[model samples]
Target: MTLRLGYGTNGLTDLRLDDALGLLADLGYDGVGLTLDHMHLDPLAPDLGARTRQVARRLAGLGLGVTVETGARYVLDPRRKHGPSLLDPDPDGRAARTALLVRAVEVAADLGAHAVHCFSGITPPDTAPDTAWQRLTGALAPVLEAADRAGVPLAVEPEPGHLLSALADFHHLRTLLGDPEPLGLTLDIGHCQCLEPASPADCVKEAGPWLRHVQIEDMRRGVHEHLPFGDGEIDFPPVLEALASTGYDGLTVVELPRHSHAGPELARTSLDFLRRAAATTNGAAPC
Candidate 1:
């Protein structure tokens, strides 16, 4: 079993999109988590279809795979980070977020990405839990249908402090959607360590069947910060072993959206750390 490594473009916000992809390729990353934002690929850019095709060509030339990420911080609302999400109170807001996700699925299809990563944003304090759940499911119906037709999986991530904040929440969502074939889980290792009752490794085992995408980073228990490999309390070797045991063929992507200042160097170090962890835990190196 081989576990490919990738890095998120959100961590390379300082670099131009082309430069970031080139840097990741040069650093031996197997894939990239392409987050659509105004500064990056800009999902709303004019002639986006042609641009997506061009990006596909670039990735093909570099021998790198991709997973379309829709968690761009300010893409939806410049005034607020990750605003107007699936759980938004207003119908129009929910529709806008859904529209963006649909576009992301289309881009993922064009790029041949294994999945499209997204999350239900924070629920308003005044909104009832049941109402928020209903909003999320209703918004996702069209997005899931789009993904199904495009032959791409919609990997919904469990975000801390969001409407869906844990593996159980994701399961609940899947259940509500009648377990749509195109719906899958974007299992973030850091999130598991921080918010889950189980260890990151255990969470991987639990999420194995529906895990279509993964985000990896070092994180402390109860904290939502994304840290470098050695800075956090997570024991990565065991986690790597668990993922390997699951026969997961997708990329374990490093996602440090806040560390773009040192993206090139950080990307190199992150890959080395993952390789060493895999070697130590599994007795063989990860490819």
Candidate 2:
């Protein structure tokens, strides 16, 4: 029951994409959470298919798996962080976000990624709850279709301060979309500690079936900041134990998008921390 660990490329923003991948590989990580940002893969860049193919080859050479992530704050609109979300009232605004997810599906398929990660944005102040739900479902439908065609799961994360920001909200979304096969969950361990009524381990156990991707970090019970392992309050041993118990085989990526200044050091220490945690779980494989 090895809980494979990887680091998010968003945290390695200071390095070139190739250099980031190489560093993770050299550190003995199993994979990477490759965010499609302007500095990285750039989903909106020209000759994207060619670029994706090149990245795919690089990943294969490095023996590192990948999960495509669409969480770049300003990729879609430079002025607005995470702008033009799926629940936007304007049709075109919603379409832009949907298109990005669809493109993510294509990239995921090309890269043989286990899942494509994304999130529901903050609800507009003027939007009604029902209307926002409607917009979210409508916008995600086509992206789900594209994922279905590409044979890639669209792993929607429950982001704090966003419209769909809880495990229950993820269930509601699954039901709303009629439980499409390609739709899955990106369970973030820190987010559970931040806001969930259940403990993070319990949340991992419960989300086992729908979970296709995962993000890990340390955080306090109420605050939303992503912190290094020992800096926060999460009891990681039980969390890793529950993750292994669930038989989830996807990469549980280290998510530290703001710590690029120490990305290389964090990446190394994070792998060591998680390896030690995994070792504490019975029948766990060694690093």
Q: Write the per-residue lDDT of candidate 1 for residues 1-287, one digit (tens) a residue.
A: 67799999999999998899999999899999999998879998898999899999999999999999999888878887788888888899999999999999999999999999999999898999999999999999999999999999999999999989999999999889899999999999999989999999999999999999999999999999999999999998888888888888888899999999988999999999998888887632577
Per-candidate total of colliding backbone pairs: 0, 0
> What TM-score would each prediction reach against the true structure?
0.98, 0.99
lDDT of 1 at 255: 91
Which pairs of residues have clashing backbones in candidate 2? none
Query: Lowest lDDT 10-mer window, candidate 1?
Result: 278-287
Per-residue lDDT over 1-287 for candidate 2, one digit per residue giving the tens place of the 0 to 100 score: 77778899999999999999999999999999999999989999998999999999999999999999999999999999999899887899999999999999999999999999999999999899989999999999999999999999999999999989999999999999899999999999999999999999999999999999999999999999999998999999898888878889999999999999999999999999888877777745645
Off by over 4 Å in 1: none
